[model samples]
Target chain A: MPEIANTAAKVAVAMTVNGRLVSAELDPRTLLVQFLREKLLLTGTHVGCDTSQCGACVVHVDGAAVKSCTMLAIQADGMSVTTIEGLAGASGLHPMQEAFREHHGLQCGFCTPGMIMTALDMVARLGPDLDEATIRENLDGNLCRCTGYHNIVKAIGAGAAAMGAGAKVAAE
Target chain B: MYAFDYQRPAALADAAALLKADPEAKILAGGQTLLPTLKQRLAQPTALVDLARLPGLSAIEKTAEGVAIGALVKHAAVATSDVVRAAIPALADLAGLIGDPAVRNRGTLGGSLANDDPTADYPAAVLALNATVVTDRRSIGAGDYFQGLFTTALEEGEIITRVDFPQVERAGYAKFRNPASRYAMAGVFVAKTADAVRVAVTGAGQSGVFLWEEAGDILASDFSPAALARLELDPADLMSDLHGSAEYRAQLVKAMAKRAVAKALA
Candidate 1:
C-alpha cells in the first residue's frame, strides 16, 4: 500500500494564476485541472476526457499550452499559469476570443476554452499568418465532441490574422 | 490517482539519493505518460521524485560528433530548435509529429525514451540515428538500451541525463498513425551514415522496435525505394490488435520504410 494514503498529508503549492499569486495546501495527487477548477474556482478550463488525448483542459504553463489534467498541481509549483479567464483584459475580449464569436466557432461551447487557449499558443509560436493546413494539423490534440471543427478551424485562421493586426497596431 | 509523496530535489545528487532511499519512488519527467497511468490506477507508486528543479538537464547543444539533447528537452523545443533542425532535421520533424501542440509542449525526449512505449516514435529515431543514452551512472548505446515493450536497460534509481545523436548523412521518418490516438501503427526511420545504412521500425514489431536488417542490407547497396519493392516483413513478427492485423502491419512496415527512404532521398 502507498504510505501517503493513510495519512492526511498535504503538499504546499504556490504559483501565479492569471497574473495573481495563489497558494494552497493540496493533496499530492491533486491535478492542475483540479487545482484550477476545484480549489481556485477558476472553472473555465473543462475536463473533457480526463486523459491526455482531449485538450479540453488545456492551459498555458510558463507561456506554453499544456494539458492540465496530466500534470499534478505540485509539479506546477513556482510556475505561471494562464487560463481562458486570463485572456481578456479591461480593453475587452482578446482578438482570438473575438474571432471565435464572429466565426461561430462553437456549438455546445464545451471545447471553446481549450480551443481559444490552444489557438493563442499556436499564434504565439507559429506566427499570425497561419495557413489552413497548418491550423488543422496544430489542432490535433484538441477534440470537439460537437464535431464543430470546421468552424473551429475557420475561427483559428481568422483569429491568427487579427492577432497579427493587433500586434501591428500596438507596435505603432 | 492514489496519494503519494512528492519530492522536488534541486540537485541531481539529491534526486538520486531520494530514489535510492525509497524503492517505490518513481521519477517524474514530463509526466505526460506517468501521470495518465497513475490516474487510471495502473500504478501505485509510494513517492514521485520530480526532476523539474534539477539543472543542466534541459540544454540542447551541438557537439563535434552530432547534437546532444538534454533528457528534459520538450518535444516542442526540439521541433522548433534551430540547432536541432540544422543538425538533424528529421529528428525535428519527428518531434513535431508527436501527439498535438499541447502534448509537444510537455513531452520530453527522455520521458518518451524512458517509458519505451511500444508505439512511441522516439525509439525508431534513436535506433536509426545510432544515438547514445547518457545517464547519471553510465552511457548506454541505443542498440543495447531498448529491451522490449515498456522496458529499458535502466535499473532502479538510475536516471537518463541526455542523448547524444551522432550526425548522419541523410535520414527520414514516416509513420502510419492511429488517427484517433495519433500513435504510430507502423513507423519506419531510415538513416545513411558515412559507412552504413540503418533502418529501424516501430509500432509494428511484436517484441517492440527492431531493426529490419534485411531492409538495411538492401538499402546499403541500392539506397532507393525501388530496391525494396520486393522486400516483405514476416507477419509473425508484427503486432495485431483491434487497430490492425499482423499482416496489415507487416505491409505497413514495408510501405512506411519505402516512404521514409524516399523522404530521405528527397
Candidate 2:
C-alpha cells in the first residue's frame, strides 16, 4: 500500500476511477471528493456545500449517483467511481453535457457537473421519455442557483431523448 | 473532519467485534447522516467500522410475513426493488420520496432506523406498517424501536440486521417536505391490514416519531379521509422550528393524515 503521509491512521484505497485503476493511502476522514480533487487531480467534481445538502459533489459510485462529499474515500474502496469528467469521450461530449451546452442549461456553471451526472443517472433509472413533472421531481438532490433551473430541466429532457437514440444506434 | 481509524470488516461477526471493542466507535452503514455530522464537527468518533462490505446485508426479499429488508439495503434499492414494489408499493413509494436521488442511492435502511432522526421518513413507515426490526441479538417491535429524537431502542454495539414489514391490504404515505432539504416538515403514514389500522406521524414530533392513536382509532373504524375530521393533535408536544409553528404542524398533521388515508384508498 502506498501511504500518502505520516498519520496516526491511513486507509489504503484501490478503486477504478473513470476507466483507470488508481490506488492511494489517505486519511480515514478524507471525503471521496477530496480524493478526486487532491489526489487524482480530477477537479470536475465540484464541492459546493461541504454539507450533503447541495448536490454539487454528485458522482456515480458503482454506477449509482451519490453525493461524493458525504462519502469517505476509504468507503469507496474497490468500487468503480465515476466523476463528471468521465462522461465525455475523446471525440465528443456526453449526450447530457452536449444537451446542457446546447440549451444553455447553466450560467455560473458551478452546479453543471453535478447536474449532468445526476441527469444521466436519472435517465438511466427512470428511462428515456421522462415527463416534465418527473424530471422536476427527480432533480431533488441537484440544485442550480443560477438560471432558476428552467433551462436545466429542458436540457435533461432533450438529453434523455438523445441518449435513447444513441442507445438505439449502438443496439442496431 | 477529524481523522479516525477506518475498518471495513468483511464479516458481520468481525464488524460487531470491532464495534464492541471501541467505546467511541461508530458504525458506518451508508454515511449519509454520519458523514455530514462528522463534517460539521457535531460528532467525533475514534473509529468507524464500515458494515457495507458485509455480504447478505443488502437483500430485499418478500417473506411469508412481509418484505424483509436487509440493514445495508440502500433507499434507492428499496425504492426500485421489484420485490419491494410488488409486495409493499406504499413502502417503496415512501422510500422513493426520501431525501433525493443522490441521497437515496447512498442512504440505507439500517442507518436511518438506527439514527432515528425525528424528521426521518422511514420511522413513519416502520411504525405504521408495524414492522419488526431484526438485530443481530434480537428482534424489536417498531413501536418499541423508536425512543426519541435521534434515539432508538438499539443498544450500544448492537446492529440491525433487517426490517420486516408485514404485508398490508393497503398503505400510503404523504408528507410536506422542506423545500431546501427534502426532509419532511410533516409526514404521515397510514397502513391497514386485515385486522388493524395504523397511523404514524413523523417530522413534527418534539419527542420524535410517534403514533397518532386518535387518528388510528378513527381510521380503524371508517378508513377514510373524513374519519380524521374530529382529530386534533396537542400542539404542546409537537415540534416548532423556523419552518413552521407547532400550531401549523398540528394542522399539517391532520392534513397529511387525510391525504395519506385518501392515497391508501386510491
Candidate 3:
C-alpha cells in the first residue's frame, strides 16, 4: 500500500504557460480557468458559462484544444498550456486574429480569444486547408451569443490560408 | 468542487492503495465529467487519485484479436487513430460523434465506461461488439460489465487498465443526439460476427444499455435493414423526458437500429 498523506488545504502546482514556466500554491478546487484568469490575470480567456458547454474558456493544453472550465489547475501540472495571451509574439498578431479582424468576426469580441485559440489548434491538427463544413462542425463546442458565426467561419478559413503561407515563408 | 487531497501515483499498485484507503476517493481520469459534477456539488469525493501519471494506459495497439485500447486513451485519440480506423471504422466513427473536439480531447474511454451514463455512446458499442473490460483486478465480459445507469461491475479500488475489443465482420452505430448536451437520446450499435449478430440500444432504455435479442435474432437470419422493419419496441421500457416522449424514443430506437444495420451492410 502507498503511504497516505494528510489532506492539505493547498497543493503546489507548476506548469508551462505560454512558453514560460510558472509555479504556484493553490487550493485543490482551483480550476484551470480560475488559475489563468484570477491568479495570472490572463483574463483574455473568458468564462461565458461556468458549465463546460461554452467554449469561451477553450485553450490549448499540450497542443490540443480542451475546455479549461472542465479541467483542474492541478491536472495541468507539469504540462504546457497556451492561452489567448500566448498567441502574439514578435509578430503583431497571429494570422487567425488578423483574419478575424479582417473578416469582422466579432461584434462583442467576448468569444474571439477562444475562437482564435481553437482555430489555431484546428489548423495544427487538420492543417490549413479547412472547409466550411469542417469549420462549422468543429465549432460545436463554441457558442457565439451574437450569432456572428458566418463571419467567424470566414475568418477561420482566411486565417488558415494565411497561416499556411506564413509557414511556407518561414520555411523558405 | 470541495477541497480534497490530490495524488498522482506513478504505479497502479499505489493508485489502488490510495482508493483502498479512502472509500470516498475517486479516480480522476481526464476529468471531463467528474469536474463538471464536482462544480455542481453533485458529488463530494474526499480525494482525487489522478491517473495522469500512471504509465502504459494511453496506448492504442492492434492485436491478433482486434484492438486493445488503454484506459487513459482520450476520445480524440481513438477517433483519429489510424489503427482504430483500419481495424474498426465503426468504433472510430462512434468516437467522432462524441460531445465535441474539446470534450473529446479530455474525455477517456475508461472514464466513459466507468461512468456508464445511459445516454453515452460507448456503452452501445461495448455491448454490441462484445468488448472486454480489463481492470487491475479482473477481466469482465461486456455481458457482465454494465449493470444500470451509472453502474458497472467495477468494485471499489478496482481501476480499469484497458479494454480489448474484438474485431467484428461488420459493425455500425447511429445516434439521435440531444441538441443541448449532445448526449444520445436514442443510439444503436449493430454488429455482425462470423456466426452471430448483436444489437445494443442505448439512451432509450429506462434501465440502461440493453441487447435487443429479438432484433439480433431477426438480423442473424436476414441481416439487412428490411429485416428489422417489422419489429417494434415497447415504449413502457424506455425513458421519457422533455426532449422526447417514451413513445418517441421507442420509434427512434428502431430507426437508429435500421440506420446502423444499413451502415454495416454498406
What shift in Å separates residue A57 of candidate 3 from its native position after superposition?
0.3
Question: Which should have the higher DockQ, number 1 or number 3?
Answer: 1
Candidate 3 structure quality by residue, lDDT tens digits, B1-266: 66788888999999999999999999999998899998988987888999987999999999999999999999999999999999999999999999989999999999999999999999999999999999999999999999998999999989999999999999999999998899999999999998999999999998899999999999999999998899998899899999999999999999999999999988
Best by DockQ: 1
- Residue pairs in steric clash, candidate 3? none
Q: What is the i-RMS of every prediction?
A: 2.0, 3.9, 4.1
Reference A-B contact fraction recovered by candidate 3: 0.77
Candidates in order have lDDT scores of 0.93, 0.91, 0.93
Q: Compared with the real two-chain complex, what DockQ does model 2 have?
A: 0.56
Q: Tell me each candidate's TM-score.
A: 0.98, 0.97, 0.97
Off by over 4 Å in 3: A1-7
Q: Model 2 chain B — which ten-residue stretch has the worst lDDT? A: B1-10
Q: What are the per-residue Cα lDDT tens digits for candidate 2 across A1-172?
A: 7433324478788999998999998888988999999999999999998787889999999999999999998889999999988988988999999999999999999999999999989898989898889998888888888889999999999999999999999999
Chain B vs. true chain B: TM-score per candidate: 0.99, 0.98, 0.99
Which scores higher on lDDT, 1 or 2? 1
Show the lowest summed lDDT stretch of 10 residues, model 3 chain A. A1-10
Cα miss at B224, model 2 (Å)? 0.6
lDDT of 2 at B235: 94
**Per-residue alpha-carbon lDDT of model 1 for B1-266, expressed as tens digits?**
77788898999999999999999889999999999999889998889999977899999999999999999999999999999999988999899888888989889999999999999999999999989999999999999999999999999999999999988999999999999888999989999987789999999998899999999999999999999999989999789999999999999999999999999998
